[model samples]
Target chain A: MRQTILSISNLSKTFGGVVATDDLSLDVEQGELHAIIGPNGAGKTTLIAQLSGEIFPDNGRILFQNKNITMLPPFKRSHLGIARSFQITSLMQGMDVIDNVALATQANDGHAYKFWKPARDDRDLRQSAIDALKEVGLEGREFEKVQNLSHGEHRQLEIAMALATQPHLLLLDEPMAGMGTEEGDKILKILQKLKKRKTILLIEHDMDVVFALADRITVLVYGRAIASGSPQSIKTDERVREAYLGTEGDLNC
Target chain B: MRNLLTRKSFNFAFIISVGLLALLPLYVEMTGDDFYLDLANRLMILAIAAVSLNLILGHGGMISFGHAAYLGIGAYSVGIPAYYEIYDGLFQIITAVFVSGVFALLTGAVSLRTKGVYFIMITMAFTQMAFFGIVSIEEYGGDDGLVIDTRSTFGNFFDLEDTVTLYYFVFVSLLISLFIVKRIMESRFGMVISGSKSNERRMQSIGYNTYRYKLVCYVLSGCLCGYAGALLGNFTNFISPEMMDWTASGELIFMVLLGGSGALLGPLWGAASFVLLEEWLSSITTYWHFFFGALLILVVLFARGGIDGLLSKIGLSK
Candidate 1:
């Protein structure tokens, strides 16, 4: 029996009469790889924003670990075991990969305000950051700064940062967005491995990756949850076909 | 080992520079050049101010244009208490920091709402407002400036009335500010600021409340600047509303840009260069402001990251 780790109830967000999310409700089960699939501007990013506490919905309730957390700040949400990776690669361009990952680890540690002892000297935090880097197959690239890393490597580093938080649920936005087929396959392998331990809410446009990995898929169109179910069910839904996945559908998730 | 050598070279250069500066007062004393010591003292004080700005601008990626206002506030922190006959040095310094900190917190909360150039403009506007408010105080010297009647006393711990002692005091304050900033910039909050500077929206999605992080940096920067201002008041034996003016703020910002915003030692270099340039220019020509202003414009136009950025680009920077 899979328990729900997060539950969104009747959530809606609008920006100046443009509805971003409309009466959306969903439950993310523990240890499940649930993917949210939609065309561009389908409120997917907005939903992620609200879930991650970056944006507040006009009306909604977010329950995480049986606690109401709609108004919680992003860091608090992260502390409570919800970690997210951005669609756009966002890493400190000046700092090395290990330093970046160690920063994320520092977030959950007792006090980042302690300034005298060098963070590098702390073996425990350093080891965890190293462990996260190795988990993402970025072991040897620890000393490389984000700017020097390839685009695929930046994406991989994003995952490594998310893992450093020791999150129970990883909300990954477009992990394979800019990757080539080879790079995509590499990420798919990483996601496959991660799914075994962490409950993941993946937002991806690649239907093949979506269908291959998502134990359940939710299709969103024009800020509405048009259809949701198994990949086979969503592929056959008529409303979803009209809203998206019809003749003009290119799966720009 | 090359990295170790580079680091050692940086330390050596820093020590040499400080040694040279410490000996400057002796030259002034021997040559009867009061102006030289005065200018050097001004540079040291501004260097302290610039170091604080570096905490926010370099480490946090917050390009605050109004850091000078904190200096103004800090000057008043000392000036106000002394005017009221409450001239305890430590108390005045504490008050200065508290006032500036509160101001920064409130302003940062509103200003940090916008990012990029918008943040800079909002901060600049707030500082101007502070400047104007001080100017409007007719009883407190208003537009003219307030003259301190007595030197701030620290329970006979040191004689600030002695110019040489005061110079060393300013030097020690600069060192302490640098030490504190170095620690804060290397801490976890510092990491968050660095991360947010790269990508704030990404930070949000990762569950870091970047707004709060930025606010903290702003307040810290303001408090340190206040310390500089209080020291400036004691060094000058006067305080003026002009200390809070936009030009003063702009010059401090220029110091940051000229030295290197990111490097710890950059602002000190910048302050030294800026004060020396002004002194030299004034000696050479009466129209020094015009010439110096033109040179500064050129620096801003051609030098993207100031002298430090330029050196780093050419592989000469630390």
Candidate 2:
């Protein structure tokens, strides 16, 4: 049996009167691509936020490698090898692409208190950033400003930055949220390659990509998990079909 | 090469300006006008303060409205010593830096906890507190302010009393400060600070403890400004609560914005233009502030990047 890398027990969060996440529990095994699917307002983002420490759950425990990390801040969680890509493409827009990724590499490599030598001159850091970019198929676009990149490229850069941190588990929120079929295919190929080496917890709206990539799927509806099973089982699960896939329409395409 | 020069003209403009400052003493001597020398000295000293403010206000995106408090602290570090008949230049300098650094550490620790408009208000409140505290010190001239009997002595190694010598000293100090600020901004520490400014949430999520980085920057900026305060106190031969007034802090912010905010030499240009405009306008009429205010409004409306931005437009600056 595969060892569990992440386990959530009794997770709960509420914003005002709205229940964003409710008494949710799930397990993600090492080296498995776990996909969390839900309808709009299903708290998929909220669950990712709590897991990444951006939002604290009202009540819950998050265990990573058997260590309780529910109370830790986002940076501490990042240090413990949890890197997240935002749904809104949270990148340093004014900075060059390479510098953005380089900063991520710098963040995890050592203490960022070095004040004498120029960071651009650090070959190891730059090389690691370049490698991350190369993995995302953005090798030649390093010097371009992030704001100038296409929306699809921004998503790729987001993944590159997350990858640059060398995290054990990648938390991607809507990586293909607004991508065209061509752009989606590019990202799908990159994720396919990544699945061979890295464990990713993805929140996706595209059923084709979800069914294609996910090893185990967790269906969420109104902040509560409806089912957790393999992709084939999740596709045909009576509750998942009624709650999410029934409304999604024509998943076989 | 031409394209490169145009693109990097800001650097060119900076070097030319510094070179002109270096030759101002010669111009003063040749024209038999010593008053210009004093004005130039004031410009360089204020430039130091402006440059320090830029580190937080421009680069770190922390709008601190009480930066002049460090200047006051720095000046008092020298003034309080001289009032006690202690005239050691090295001792005064050390005390000024240490006091200002500690002040920054303590104030930044508290003020940095609050952000946006609250940060500005909190910083202003701290400066006002310092100003009022200084005003209560009746022995140090209270509301009237204190006068230095003699310029700081450097163990007979140098004379700050000589105008030419003092000019060079302030000039070299400005160069050293620019070097230090530039180096820090290019380093890893600078990346974190700048990154935090761009997107603070992203920085935190990327495993950077942005608070510590920002606090360090605040303290560093404060200490540098405090050093400038020491120089200002010596140059004027006076230290006053007026130096730490909220208006004084506002002027420093204006200087940073009046020049391009993020550029290293932006504050230097801002200080020069501001002081020069003040001198020229005040010579023509008593209501110089009206014209200064109008000019500032115009700059804000048209040249959003300040003098540096305008120069860059004309292919004369970086």
Candidate 3:
């Protein structure tokens, strides 16, 4: 039996009168690549926000390694090994690619109050960043400024940044969103490799990638989980088809 | 723009500026131009204060409009003690650093919680408060200010009596301030502060408590500016509520931006330009400030990195 690495129960959040997350509960086992998919306004990103501690849920309990982390701040959650990539492509636009990843690596290293020695000269930090960049196929472009990188490169950098944290669970909010087929395929390959070693809770809109990558799939509609199971089970669920998946003819597989 | 200024022209501009400052005393001694030496002394002190401002304002991306309050606090550290015959330079320097550091810690704690225009307003309000607080104090001479009968004395270390001695003292302080700012920016602490300025959310999500880093930087900046104030008090031989005025703080900000806010040597250039322009323009006309204001507007309109930006682009092209 696989151990549950992350557990969320009765998670709920609201903005004014609109229910962004309505009594949502989910769980992912160790090393499982769980995918959450839905149409627009399905609260997928909102759910990721709560999990990453960007915003607190109205009511819920989040257990990471059996520790309650629901009220923890974002940085504290990061320290606990929960890393996230934003849907809007958030990064330090001023810094270069390697330094960006190096900063993320430095974050998890230890206290940063060392106000004398140069951080850029630390061999261990730079090496770890290089390793993460190489993993994301961004090795040769380490010196490139983030502002000059293409959108696809930005996504790759985003993944590299998440990986540099050495996180146990990566909450990737649409890693392949707005990418061309070539870029999307690169991300798919990276995710395929990552799934073997890390537990990733991904939110993606591409059904083919979802069905192709996720070990387990959860269908969300209007902030509620309508269906969650293996790929074949979710593909046939009547409620999921009516609410989100649509006709089986569109599955294309 | 990365280091608050481009690195391209840094070598060219910084070396030239420092060389000139280093040779100024010898030139003055040979030419017997004591007036110019005095002017350079005042210029360097303000430069030290501006450099301290640049640390938080430029690299750390914290806009503090109330930095001059620390200047007043530092000056008063000397003025008040000297009034009662406490002339130990060690006590004065420590008081300047400790008192201003504490003040920054308290005010920065409140100021840093805000952002954008509100941050500017709240900081200005604090300076106004400090200004009025001193104005209302009768024992410190209120608006009339205080005159120090005897300058601060160090125990056989160095005396601040002679203008030449004071000039060297101020010069060394300026260099030290620049060195400190440079070291801090390259340090691990500097990286976090710069990262926080770039994308604070990213910094937090990456597991850094950015608030604490920024607070420490703010306090350090305040302490350095306070030391500059102590030197200012000694130079003018006076202390007054006028030292902490919001306008004085605004001038400091102007110097930072005019020189190039983030570049290591930007403040030095800014303070030099301000002093020279003020002196030259006033000598030419009674309304010389009109021309100075116009010149500043022109620089703002034309220069991207202020003086640093223009020079870097030139350096880039060549």
Task: State the local distance difference test value for candidate 1.
Answer: 0.85
lDDT of 3 by residue, A176-252 (tens): 98999999999999999999999999999889999999999998888999899999998878888788755544454
Question: What TM-score against the true fold does each predicted structure earn?
Answer: 0.90, 0.97, 0.96
Candidate 2 per-residue lDDT, tens place, B74-137, comes to: 8888888999989898999888888888989999999989989999999999889999999998
TM-score of candidate 1 versus the correct structure, residues matched by position: 0.90
Assess the local accuracy of residue A133 in candidate 1 as a C-alpha lDDT between 0 and 100: 93
Off by over 4 Å in 3: A245-249, B1-10, B316-318
TM-score of chain A of each: 0.96, 0.97, 0.97
**Top candidate by TM-score:** 2
Clashing pairs in 2: B9-B317, B9-B318, B10-B317, B10-B318
Between candidates 1 and 3, which one is better according to lDDT?
Answer: 3
How good is model 2 by TM-score? Answer: 0.97
Query: Per-residue lDDT tens digits of candidate 3, residues B6-51?
Result: 3443376677767887888889889997898889988999999999
Candidate 1 Cα misplacement greater than 4 A, ranges = A14-20, A232-244, A247-253, B1-9, B84-87, B114-118, B136-138, B311-317
Better of 2 and 3 by lDDT: 2
Cα lDDT tens digits, model 1, A100-192, are 898888777746666566566667887899899989999888777789999999999999999998998899999997899999999999999
